[model samples]
Target: MRESAAAWGLQLARALGALWTSPNTLVGLLAGVAGMAAGARPHWNRRDCALVFHRWPWGPGGAITLGMVILHTGDTLDVSCTTYEHRAGRCEHPRVRLGDHERAHVFQYMVLGPLFLPVYLLCGGVSVRNPFERAADRYAMHGRGWWPGRS
Candidate 1:
């Protein structure tokens, strides 16, 4: 019985994956864009994307979003390890120490509390931009290439 249940679950997951990747999904993509903007998580830069999806030692509120799951690559393993949670709903540069509590305060205000909450909520369900894609888009015209076979 358990084996059958697991197999059925896997099939359902596969179907969902296919649906998510289908071009037709774009028909309703505006909702997603609006939600992202609402969360106040406008894509800042490559690093911003990284902080959103990889930063760890997370405070309290954070969760894995579809974007992060899809964008992750093997090279980001180190950054991923360093970040405690990777889903704080707001983006900030992660640091090892609190820096006399000054930076910690900033994170608390700018990211954790009121300032960032509305935006995070607006993004709908804690989704973040995909860092790999953001980086590729930013450096697309660099000619040679930042990394081989990256595109």
Candidate 2:
């Protein structure tokens, strides 16, 4: 009974989180729809719980995650291990795929909701100094959860 209750609670929380983040998700969906009009393709990644739009026409040629949507340029991306290396001292950079990096962003969007864009921009926007990007890179390289609890 306790286990089932916990599962139910978790599901409830997830549904709430989706609702909380829906506004940002709407923007992502609009972008994806525009991309679709311009010949992009959308796919649902069950494992990542994200709608990925491939061949996105905008952005600087990589992947960008907004809430549950991932707009990806048509290319391969290999993220490096900077956070883990900075904290634990390792030099090996893994060849993690772009989807993994974008998945991290989705998780961030889940937590931050509408505040994600402002916070991300304030943190320096697409650089190593930005903790969000670093967290995303760490998740990509280490395959761990996106949220780094503390430094």
Candidate 3:
């Protein structure tokens, strides 16, 4: 009973977070829909709790996360990307650790909601000088906490 109650509380918190972040998520949905219409195949990454759109058109290459959506330039971005099904799609990401970095951004969107993009831009967008990106990189590289702070 205690476990169930805790689970319920967690679910409630997650729902609230989703609501808070819905605006950003809606923007992602629009972009994802555009990408889908441009030939990208959409796949659900349950582990990452995101809508992963593979083969997104435009932009050099690499993945970008908007709220709960991930627009990637390659094929699969799942942890199970080694499976035959994913390999058949030609997973071309130079970095296999991308999901964690992007997932960190997703979490940031949950916390910051509408302010995430502004903060990210102010922090230098996608550069190494960005604390958010640093934190996300740490999480991806060392599997540590992704919250922005020292180390």
Model 1 Cα shift for residue 60 (angstroms): 23
Where does model 1 exceed 4 Å of error?
21-69, 72-80, 84-151
- Stretches of candidate 2 exceeding 4 Å from the true structure: 75-91, 149-151
- lDDT per residue (tens digit) for residues 1-151 in model 1: 9999999987686455434433322321333344444342322123222122223222343222222121112223223221222334354434322111112222222222333334435534222353322222223323222221353
1-151 per-residue lDDT for model 3 (tens digits): 9999999998897687778888888888888889888898888887777888889996887788888888898887644222112234533333337787788788888889888999999998876667897687666656676788945
- Per-model C-alpha RMSD: 17.3, 3.7, 7.1
Order of quality (TM-score): 3, 2, 1
Which digits, one per residue and each the tens of the lDDT, describe model 2 over residues 39-125? 778888866678888888887777778889888887333433244344444455655666777878877888788998998999888
TM-scores for all predictions = 0.23, 0.81, 0.81
lDDT of prediction 1: 0.30
Give one clash count per candidate, in the order shown.
9, 0, 0
Error of 2 at 3 (Å): 3.7
lDDT of each: 0.30, 0.76, 0.76
What's the candidate order when arranged by decreasing lDDT?
3, 2, 1
